[model samples]
Target: MNIHLIAVPYDSAVRGWRMGAGPEALLRSGLEDHLRARGHHVATEIVEAPDDGPATEIRTAFVLAAALRDRVRTAREAGALAVVLAGNCGSALGTVAALAEDEPLVVWMDAHGDLNTPETSRSGFLDGMALAILTGHCWAPMAASLLPRPVAEDHVLLVGARDLDAGEQALLADSAIRLVHADAARAECRGCWTPHAR
Candidate 1:
């Protein structure tokens, strides 16, 4: 299989800081070579934000998402699987938007629920709201600018999201999206023996 490894090395609008360093670090760690060893044809691309003045979390994130959307679309056109290595989970907006026409099912694997909206998030962290944006719970106009339509909650599966905020938990309980806690997922992996829930 052909793979397009798109890297977005930005964390909350800043470049190469904190989690932003992860994307390049993965490449330097021979990720491409490892994939090739596994018999996959791998190609890579780095996505960057513009140098226009100062960067705000919301603006820069959207810009990066738009750029990533384009690259992902190109990869799909060439029949290559587009795999994004991004620091911020919000970068998923790009990948989802690029595939919006297909109405794909989203299987999110993360420690945090990422289902917080601006109103529900105490930290005011944009990445915390990634899943909310994807499901049209918030940021409707901006999200719609990129995606033709929001992904249905029933089409989403949140796996191993053990660190959910109260608001996220409430939202999840009311939504159609399926949630598989970490312990239950591990139990499934181990067949008959289930790990004790913490």
Candidate 2:
């Protein structure tokens, strides 16, 4: 398979700090060579925000998302499996926008429920609102700017989420999005799982 590895090396829209270093670290660890050893052809691209670009997290995220959208679309057109290495979950908005078609099934694996909107977010972490943006619950304009369509809530499956904020928990309880607890996921893989309330 041909793999297009696009790296978004920014965390909180800022460059050269924190999680932003993750992409380079992964590359330095020989991710490309490992994939080649496994017989997959790899192409790489790195997304960098302008030094003088928007300083706010949300604004910077949108900028990165737009760039990612174009790159992901190009990879798809070239018949390559686009693999995005991103510093934060917010980069997923661009990925989903570029790839989603006819109600795509989103299997999100994470330790925390990234379902908080700006209104419900107590920590003010913009990455927490990524899923909300993808589903069009918040940041509609920003989301639409990248991709006009919103992924359906029923088609999203949240797996391995063990930590959730109060607002996120409340929202999940009232929403149609499916949840698979970490324990349940592990048990199911081992063929010893049973149905239970999330």
Candidate 3:
């Protein structure tokens, strides 16, 4: 199998994280080497870092989002599967929404649902609202562009969620992303879900 790695480091609309170094962490952790040993070919594309460090972190986040969308578009044109690891999951959501199709299911693997709209979002940061953006709930133009173009609400699924805000809750009640919280499972279910773990 051939897997393409895409990294989105920041979210203009959300709080920032050490997420910019996620690619470095994975490589240093031997993720690629291990994959190769398993006979899986791995190709990586880093979201080009912006040179505006002294600026507000929010500014840097928007720059990072654009770079990631460009990479994701390139990868999509080439027909490649992707794994986007970033702190602001909401930031890269546009890319994710653009890539989603009815063929393969997209499973948002995370502790937070990442689903909040700007209006519904208590936090103005876009990262917290990624799931909300991707599902086409509410967002800025750029973030909205990355979604399914008049996005379909039924194609999303959320697993391993531990938290969500009030507005996010209201939106979730209206959309199709099914959230399976962490504590709702028994040991047997957890064991069964391990293979699909993700």
Candidate 4:
């Protein structure tokens, strides 16, 4: 299999800080070499926002998304699997946008639900609203333009979300996205759930 490793080395629009350092660190740790040893052909690219202005969390995030979307599209057209290593979960927006025509299922595994809207996000952290944007729960105009169509909630599975805010919890309860607790996932190894939908 041909694999494209697309790295976005920025966290909250800042490079080389906090989670932003992760992608480079993983590269330096020789992840590409390890994958090559497994016999899969690998290629790498780093997505970067233009240095035209000061970086703000939200604006630069979308800029990065657009850049990533193009790169992912190019990789897919070349029949390579695009593996995105991103500092923030919002990078999923770019990936999904590139594959929107395929109507892919989304499996989101995170300690906290990335389900907050502008109205409910106390921290104003754009990353917190990533999944919400995908589900059309917030940032409607921008998300719609990027995603082509809203992803069906039933096609999304939010797993290991133990740190949900009240608003996120309420939204999850109302959404069709499957919520799988980390504990429940462990039990699944012992046949806690059948493959059939519940």
Candidate 5:
């Protein structure tokens, strides 16, 4: 298998802080070497925020997402699996944009339900609205900038979500997106997996 690794080393709109360092940390931990040892061809690209960039978190997210979308598209054109190592969930928008042809099913595994919209969010955290953007719940202009295709709510499966705000909880209950609680996830996984007969 050929894998194209896209590294996003920024958290929210801020550069070089917090989760922003995760991608480089993973790379330093011999990720490339480990993948090569597993007999896969690997290529890497780093997506960085411009030195003079957007002033707001939302704008910054869109800028980075656009870059990631282009890179993902290029990777797909070259017949490589695009794997994004991102600092935040907002980057998922770019991944979805690149791959959402004929409405691809999205399996999102996150600690929080990242389904808050501008109207429902209390913390004012832009990253919290990433899933909403992907589902066309808000940020229509920014979402359309990358790609107009929005993953249908029914096609979204959110796993391992344990930290959700009241708004997020209410929204989840009303929406078609499937939720697999963190506690029950392991049991569900075990039930789904079966050993093949030799």
Candidate 6:
């Protein structure tokens, strides 16, 4: 299988993961070699932020968004079958928007539903509002980058989700996402000694 790895490296404003170290840790945890050993061609790229990139909160979103916009576009055009945009959901969402040109089938695998809009977001973190933007529920500026259209709410499925934020629950009720809570999705999979809970 062909894989394009787009790294996000943002950790919300949680005070632990915004440092861009997340990608390094994944590499250290054997992401590249393990995939190559399995006969997958894994192409790699990073969301390049300045060493002195803006440290302010909201501006950080645009800085990160600009970086991700370029990275995902460059990687998407490199000609891969599947692109893995992994890491902080904030940057990941921007990458997905950039890649919406591919007419993607987005499988959002996460613990939280990630369906919060900026207006509804109690936390005000971009990470929490990623799914809402992708669904085209809000975020006119960000969604505008996804030429032709945004990922349809119907085509964007969710799995491995056990928890739901209050905002997410409301959105899910009104939205068309094919949300499979972790247990049900696992139980529905065919013929595996151990189901892929992740």
Candidate of highest lDDT: 1
What is candidate 2's lDDT per residue for 2-77, written digit by digit as tens? 9999999988887756988898899989999999999999999999876784488888899899999899999999
Alpha carbon deviation, residue 37, candidate 4 (Å): 2.3
> lDDT per residue, candidate 4, 47-68, as tens digits?
8889998998888888899899
Candidate 5 backbone clash number: 0
Candidate 5: stretches off by over 4 Å: 190-198
- Give per-residue CA lDDT, model 5, range 126-197, as digits (tens): 889999889888898778888766789999999999999988998888999999999889777875766883
- Candidate 5 has which clashing residue pairs, if any? none
Cα RMSDs, all models: 3.8, 4.7, 4.1, 4.5, 3.1, 3.8
Give the better candidate number (4 or 5) by lDDT: 4
Q: Looking at candidate 5, what is the lDDT of residue 175? A: 90
TM-score of every model versus the real structure: 0.92, 0.90, 0.72, 0.92, 0.90, 0.74
C-alpha-based local distance difference test score of model 5: 0.89
Candidate 1 local distance difference test against the native: 0.95
Predicted candidate 1 versus true structure: per-residue lDDT over 1-198, tens digit per residue: 999999999999999989999999999999999999999999999998899879999989999999999999999999999999999899999989998999989999999999999999999999999999999999999998888999999999999999999999999989999999999998888865546753
lDDT of 6 by residue, 88-194 (tens): 67665566667676777889888987787876788776767777777777776755654356678888889988878877888898888988889887788745655
Which scores greater on lDDT, model 4 or model 6? 4
Error of 1 at 11 (Å): 0.7
20 in model 6: Cα distance from truth in Å? Answer: 4.6
Candidate 6 TM-score to native: 0.74
